[model samples]
Target: MSRRIKGLVEFEDDNGAVVRYLRHPHGGGLVSPAAHAHEGAWLAETSYVEAGAVVHDGARVGPGSWVDVDVVVGARAVVGSNVHLGAGTRVGSGARVGTGARVGERVSIEPRATVTADQVVPDGATVGGSGTGRRSGYGRAA
Candidate 1:
């Protein structure tokens, strides 16, 4: 069965849709459900996801960041304030995208991969050592 891990931020009503979280000791915090879009196939309105984070379509985030879902940010990779996704852009599990480094189309980042700190990933482009070799896997780095 699928279960959620502790410390990670996830939606309580969105079928366990994962959101961003603050690292323990560093500042583990909670997701804020404010000024957000609670409909559609993505997170909506006034959210601010941080670098290396992700969200997928159909994933509902009230006012937080999506960091995990298959441990990858897909379609609606939603993000919120101060949230980090690490890597692994497989946010297809009802993502809620926000600010910060979002997962691009056909892109796959490694788990716990830091997508923050000026890491720019284009559409259909892979960033870390995951998925198939090459930048996007479907082809070579352009």
Candidate 2:
């Protein structure tokens, strides 16, 4: 059985819909009504996870991070402080987004990809491969 870590409060969404969110443990973060975060996920205080976002077990979202709509922060992924993950962004399992990284809208980081601390990824960019590198495009090169 899961216990209530915090209370629920209502807020108005951009579309004028009243959305409710659950406050995280120790006043860490706010989990949206439409978002799902595993118990092991560590959301620091001041972070806001938007609707449809899923934070898997062992993932840690630092303070002030903004996880936009439909974003998926994979298991064990570490999102640094103040990171802005745009809508539809996917931080693959085991990926690490460095502090203050500005990930543009719809960016997809492949599994195990590491966006070096403070890296900036443009909108629609795809970061992949077996090592740390920044490639500007939609997909990996053939």
Report, for every candidate in turn, its global Cα lDDT versus the true structure: 0.38, 0.82
For all predictions, the C-alpha RMSD in Å is 13.3, 5.1
Compare the candidates by lDDT and give the number of the best one: 2
Candidate 2 ranges beyond 4 A from true positions: 1-6, 11-19, 131-142
- Which regions in candidate 1 have their CA more than 4 angstroms from the true location? 1-45, 48-99, 129-142
Q: Estimate each model's TM-score.
A: 0.29, 0.80
lDDT of 2 by residue, 10-86 (tens): 66667777766788664368888789888889999789898999999989999989999999999988899999999
lDDT of 1 by residue, 69-132 (tens): 2244444333444344443445333222334544445455443233442244555554443432
Worst 10 residues of 1 by lDDT: 131-140
Best candidate per TM-score, number? 2
C-alpha lDDT of candidate 1 relative to the true structure: 0.38
In candidate 2, position 113 carries an lDDT of: 82
